[model samples]
Target: MSIEIPGYRSGTWVLDPAHSEVTFSVRHMMISKVRGTFGVKEATLIAPENPLEAKVEAKVDVSSIDTKDEGRDAHLRSADFFDVENHPVMTFTSTGTRVQNGDFLVDGDLTIRGITKPVTFEFDFGGFGKDPQGNYKAGASATAVIDREEFGLTWNAALETGGVLVGKEVTIGLDLQGALQV
Candidate 1:
């Protein structure tokens, strides 16, 4: 079976930052998870008649990384992690879409800190509707796991017990809402 979004229309959709978010989490201290969110600078969706033919491009503000802790946030902006100074924005450009065993997948190139890698995100359609302001809206969510080391984010500390300070694998989640361009 193929994926379908009822009431879907072909057009350009601009991301509503107020209604969208990009979040991530990674193992911390070898025992717990550290979660954070990055501000979405901009994103666009070019929807085609067939959902599988749709295209998406997004830009995230790396300097806007927040984990609720100022110190850690600062460190993340430094050369160790995101290195926001050198690369202020991370981008994703969709390459194609496909279905696997009834699941929707979006294949894209994710660029972080100057490193670009191919990644596949499992996507879920949240349907379309008219918002309270009388604007056409579309919603969707996607998730993917990536290795930080592959993106040049290799900073870590050796734990006294046996593991490392931070986990290498990072899970990224996107809850996106967009307004159809008139």
Candidate 2:
């Protein structure tokens, strides 16, 4: 069966930062996962009929990385990790998209700490819905993994227990919802 996504016009659709966020998590000392979220400052999505032709541009405020713990969050914003002062924004742009078994695989360039790397995330299509005002909305969720060292966020400490303080692999989750303008 073919699913019809409400057609979007050929224009820029600004991401609703109020409802969107870029979050990540990593294994700490190989026993627990430490999670944090980055506030999205801006995003522009140009979705065409062909998923492969769809493009997304997003910018995240590095200074907004929050994990609820003041000390940990501060360290994440420092030079050892994100270095918010030097690299204030992390950005991403779609390169391609593919469908496998009815789900989307979105390939894109993810830039962090001045380093850009290609990453792919599996996406789930959330059907179009409408608000009380009759504005159409569509949503999707995706997840991908990244190497923190590859992005120059290589701060780590050796734990007496054996493993390092933080794991190299960082998992990212994206939950996006946008308004349709057709």
Candidate 3:
């Protein structure tokens, strides 16, 4: 079955940074998971004349990486991890877009710590509505799994029980909200 998304016109859609979030989770200590969020510096969606050709681009501030603990946050910002001082921003640019079985497959280039790789995320059109301020808003949720090592984030410690302190696989989640350009 096919359902048409609402308020998605052939025009630019500006991301609402205050309402959208990019978060991630990864296995920790081979037992549980650790989650965090990155601050989006900017994000925009250019609706192509052909709906399937839409492009989404975004920049995230590495310095805003937050996992709750200040000490761990500092370590993540250091060279051993994100090296936020040297690489302050990470970016993503969509190469292709398509609707499949009522969902969107956004194939894109993800750049992190100066390394770029192709990745695809499956997105669901959550809903569309008017915000409190009367702006027409579109909402979506996306998920993708990526290897930390692929992004040059291979730092880890050997666990006494046999695994590693951090898991190589990271699950990315995006709860996105955007408004149509007037």
Task: Point to the candidate with the largest lDDT.
Answer: 1
Model 2 off-target regions past 4 Å? Answer: 1-11
Candidate 3 lDDT by residue in tens digits, 1-182: 23345656678889989988999999999899999999888899998657687889999999999999899889989998898988999999999887777667999999999999999999988887888888878889999999989999989999788999999999999999899888
Tens digits of per-residue lDDT for model 1, 1-182: 24567788889999999999999999999799999999999999898888788898999999999999999999999998998989999999999999998788999999999999999999888999998889999899999999999999999999889899999999999999999999
Rank ordering of all candidates by TM-score, starting from the highest:
1, 3, 2
Instruction: Kindly list the per-residue Cα lDDT of model 2 for residues 136-179, writing each as its tens digit.
Output: 77677789999989999889999987989999999999888777
Please give the clash total of every predicted structure, in order: 0, 0, 0
Worst ten in a row by lDDT for model 1: 1-10
Q: List the candidates' TM-scores in order.
A: 0.97, 0.91, 0.93
> Which residue runs does candidate 1 get wrong by more than 4 Å?
1-3
Relative to the true structure, how large is the alpha-carbon lDDT of every model? 0.94, 0.83, 0.88
Comparing 2 with 3 on TM-score, the higher-scoring candidate is: 3
Model 2 is weakest, by summed lDDT over 10 consecutive residues, at 1-10
Alpha-carbon deviation at 125 in model 1, angstroms: 1.2
In model 3, which runs have C-alpha deviations exceeding 4 angstroms? Answer: 1-4
